[model samples]
Target: MSNLTIVLIILVIYMALMVLIGLQGRKHSSNMQDFLTAGKQGTLLLVTGSYMGSHIGNGIVVGGAEYGATYGIGGMWYGVGAAISFYLFAIFMARVVYRNNYVTLSDLLEQRYGDKMTSIAVALLNAVSNIAVMAGQIMAGERLFQYIGLNPLAGAIATTTIVIIYSSLSGLWGVMMTDVIQVTVIVISVIATMIFIATQGGFSIMAQNLPATSFEMIPFDGETFIMMLGPTALFGLVSSTGFQRTVSCKKEKTAILAPVLGASLILLFVPLPVMIGMYGKALWPDAASGTIIFQVLFEAMPPLLAGLLIASICAAVMSTSDGILVTVTANIVSDIYHKHINPDADEKSLGRLSRISSVVIGIFALIIALQFSSLISLLSLSYTLITAGGLVMIVGAIFWKKATRQGALASFIAGVACVVINKMGVSLPYASVFPLIPSFLAYVIVSLMTQNKNAAAA
Candidate 1:
């Protein structure tokens, strides 16, 4: 059989399994709470699987490989930063959010800020960020299909349909179950590739063919390390998807431990892509960025193995995309529609709305994906917006009892303004850090100024 035919068959079988899993998960989801959080009954294994699955998306694979091509071994720093941030989140953030029984970050903001407006603002910002991130995933899948000589538009539509079908059917339950399978496939693909590469004259060839810098832990210049570490760290900590995974856990300990476990697993896989990219660099020194991983996979492996690797990449993109879509839908249904539009809506009504919102949001994200061609850019923009607009407020509200509503509003506005201005070519030093400073200052200054009024009202 032709390679294309083999890949199509594998994808068909894989998607069929996903549909079956979704049907099974539907039994567990009967209400908004069940849909959004899987009834907050996830064990550590489920939480860890879902958390890691949602994170190791197409952006990480392609972007990490690109970084490896450019910066060599130090390209691993971004993933390292992400893992560190996940660990920090587990230590400082997860337990607090879980103990509060908050199903969404907006729910926690509502409780701390004592205002529906704050929740509404957060929900909108988070929805935009999630949609943008989902668009990146769709674009990633499209690129995979394009690499295999298929129309990218068709690939995107197929990706969107599968995600929406499974996600709408069972919500978090379906997402988590499929995530476990996706992560497993991802590991298998990586391992098989590693073995194949090793048997074919491994590190020795890479060492001889590549520059010394390619093996360095940190580049001699240090600029790449500095730039990668900070934003990625912040992105890891403030990720809306990460927050949802933690809240989905059945117990506080599970929530606290899952991210750490997931981060460790991520760290383990970080070297595989970097090595692949390095090898690609050794072979094609002038190849365009982001093509290294795919080029290496197709060139180095047999037809069936290459097909499995392709499916693994699709698994990565779909797993993350589905999680983002479901969370965005939940925010719309729980925070906006039910909370504001019809406060008295029953669980059954809300559940129906959640499924409908998933399809709508998936379509909107597909449109955005078709408009954008760069996965890394879209993913980075989403992370930047989420960090600037929402992270400070979330952190402050959790740890500071005196963090007032006015302060949060000011912080969010200042941060978003800074990001907008920077994006307009204003050129700021440490662009990511620039917005955060003003955001923190605005929160502190506003909260202190409003202390007397708040106390008097109390």
Candidate 2:
């Protein structure tokens, strides 16, 4: 059989397994709460795997690889930023998330501000960010399809369809079960790929062919590193998917510990793909940066291993995609419909709505993937938006009891406005991150001014 044929066969089998797991997971997710939050009883293995899986999509795959191809080992700074966020989250917000029986981060906003506008704003902004991140994951799948000699559009469509199917069928249960398998497959593939490269002289060969700068841990200027790292670090504070995963665990300790473990694993795994990209740079210096990882995969591994890795990558990418879909669905069904329209809806009705919402969100994500071909570009924008007001408000909600609804509203407005204004005419270095300054100032200044407004109630 042709190499492409073999890869396709493996991919098909892997997809079939994912669907079957989703079907089986349906038994566990009979109700809205179970579907949305996995009944808030997820085991450490399952929760840790899900946490890691959801964080390791196009950001660490295609984006990281392209970074490596461009800046060598410095590409890992992106993943490093993510790791920093996870650790920071564990230290700062784990206790707060675990103590509260919240299904989403917006719920936290509601508790702190007690305003429907704040809650809805949080949910909607997060949903928008999730859509962009999901697009990045689908883009990764699209690239993998291109590598297999298939139509990239078809690959994007098929991948989205499959994720929506399984995700809508079983919700977070299916996502977590499949996530464990996907994480296992991905970890193994990464390790095996590294081993295969080692046998071919690995970094020694890479060093000989590439510049000495290729080996530098952080290849770029400090400003570039901060631009790459800041949003990702703050992202863990406001991420809807991360919030859902945090609440899904069986215990507070599990909720706190899982992200720590996941973050450490991510820190370790970040460099593997960077090295792979460097190897590809050594092999094909002129190839497109985004295509370098797959080029290295096909050239370095045996056909069977390559095929398995390809299938694993597809599943791994979808792990995050499906989680984002589920989070958005939660916002639709619980935060909007249930909260406003019919608070007494049964599990069956909510379940139906959840499925429909996930599919709808997936469709939107597919559209976004088509509009933005660059994984990091789409991701950077999403992360920037999430961190702008989202990060500042989350911090205030957690630490500053004096923070008021009006302050949150003002913070969000100023933060989002800064981003828009920056996009229009600003010419600063790392412009994407500059909005946070105004966001934080708005939060603190407005909250202090508005404290007496809440004092009447107190």
Local distance difference test, per candidate?
0.79, 0.82
Clashing pairs in 2: none
User: Which consecutive 10 residues in model 1 have the weakest lDDT in total?
Assistant: 220-229
* Candidate 2 per-residue C-alpha lDDT over 69-92 given as tens digits, one digit per residue, 9 for 90 to 100: 888888888898888888888899
lDDT by residue (tens digit), candidate 1, 1-458? 87667866776777777778878877667777777777676888888888777756575566677678877887777777667778878877888877777777788899898888878988998898899889888886677677677898998898998788778776787888878887888778878887888898867778888889888899745444545666667776677677777777877779888999998999998777777778778888887655677777776677687677677677667767878987898789888998889999988788777778888899989999998755555666677788888888999998888889999999999999998998898987777566889999999999999999888998
After TM-score superposition, the amount by which residue 139's alpha carbon in candidate 1 deviates from its true location, in angstroms, is: 1.8
Model 2 whole-model lDDT (C-alpha atoms): 0.82
| Residue 221 displacement in candidate 2 (angstroms) | 3.0
